[model samples]
Target: MASTTEYSDRESLGVGSIVGESFSILFKNFIAVILLALAPMLLSSIIAGAMVGADVALGVADPDFSTSTSVTTWVLTIVLQIVFYALTTALLVQLAYDSKLGRPLQLGRYFSPALRAALPIAILTTISSILAGFASLALIIPGIWVYAVFSVVAPAVVIEGAGFGGLGRSAALTKGYRWPIFGALLLVGICAGIVNFLAGVFAGVLADVGSWAMIVGFSIIAALSAGLTGISIALIYARLREIKEGVTVDQIASVFD
Candidate 1:
């Protein structure tokens, strides 16, 4: 019984150690972390731009294009956005897990894995978004709960290379630890909110002071905030994987295996 107790304690320590190691990797690979964080925002912007451009070319002048005649345009836009996000995540995970710091991180490396993982990732996104929306309707707390559960979905898809099945897997891994995940996400959310609030306050002050300064400062703040958030999520995912699956960096790299 004592030996069994010792083994159980060791297992718990191992989980804590994995989480620590994940954060260490994120801090150590700061640049990559930033890129991972920014990727989603950048991809969203690109997709939005393309959709707007297509709407313009079609002579459809409306703030909302969902009612547009060309369903293909909307489908393409959604597909492209998913593909882009998946690819970005794949590249980031590949680079981070492989420890390929010196290699030139090109755009192409992101596409294949993204394409491979696109459908599952997109489905996960849709389901999570719907759940979050429903939660919001219920009240703020439910919304937060939904986000916490699905928070690891993206990382699960990218790092574990699991498809639709991975979504449930992530939820399972997060089980019995929802509060901890919630706490970590809450902290990040608070920090991000504060940063945005301060930036907005500064922007307001700066606009009164100097428009150019406001523009530059706002841009810088947005980039930094997005990057930091992305890195934090990626790192969290890595740590969760380690805890749930005993996946080391090496195993993450061997995701295809």
Candidate 2:
């Protein structure tokens, strides 16, 4: 099941190549990818919207902003997001692996590996998020830097079962290739942002007519954006392994068995 497609060698990929390859994979497996990613993405969006609604409610109902409800909502949203992102990342990585190896793209078939590795993934994702947050708080550049280095962490968790050690694995994979990774991520982000912006614009136009329609519009956009991000990262993870470990797509995917 070795792929005929040649991924870029370690440290050899440019931003354009990464972006192109990601979109290619995404388009090729559009339905499977979207379906696999939909649940987690939509749940996360609902949780996010709840968090916002909670804050708004607190502001309106309790002007002092001294409510336990706000605190609880914040905590719940953060925890749920950590789980959602981790599971979705793991699922998407497996999907990308199967896609690369020309295996069946059954959305249901990918869930077992994701759930099997759920705890470790959640832990690693939470840590990565915290570290990135701190980096951003210290300085924006460092935060972005940390994010790029840890971009492969989900793949590491899925393929190597590196758990929390996936952080180190990701950093090693990206060692001298940080710039390309960052560039690739930035381009993807810009594209996702553009789609999101367009969606928001459409939502706003609907908002003047009905709030529920706007909510539905934004929810669809959020889910689509999340799915796109997951697929792109999965592709990146596969490419990183090919380049850094000199592994074929099938060899890396064998970890699932």
Pull out the clashing pairs in model 1: 37-230
Give each model a TM-score: 0.61, 0.80
* Per-residue accuracy of model 2 over 218-252 as CA lDDT, tens digit each: 54665555666776777777777777677787888
Model 2 has an lDDT value of 0.71
Following a full C-alpha superposition, what root-mean-square deviation does model 1 have from the true structure?
7.9
The Cα local distance difference test for each model comes to 0.56, 0.71
Enumerate residue pairs that collide in model 2.
10-243
At residue 27, what lDDT does model 1 achieve? 60
The alpha-carbon RMSD values of the candidates against the true structure, listed in the order shown, are: 7.9, 6.1
Residue 150 error, candidate 2, Å = 1.3
Candidate 1 per-residue C-alpha lDDT over 103-214 given as tens digits, one digit per residue, 9 for 90 to 100 = 4444445546656776788778767766777888978767776776777676677666668886697777666555555656666666667766675566566655554445
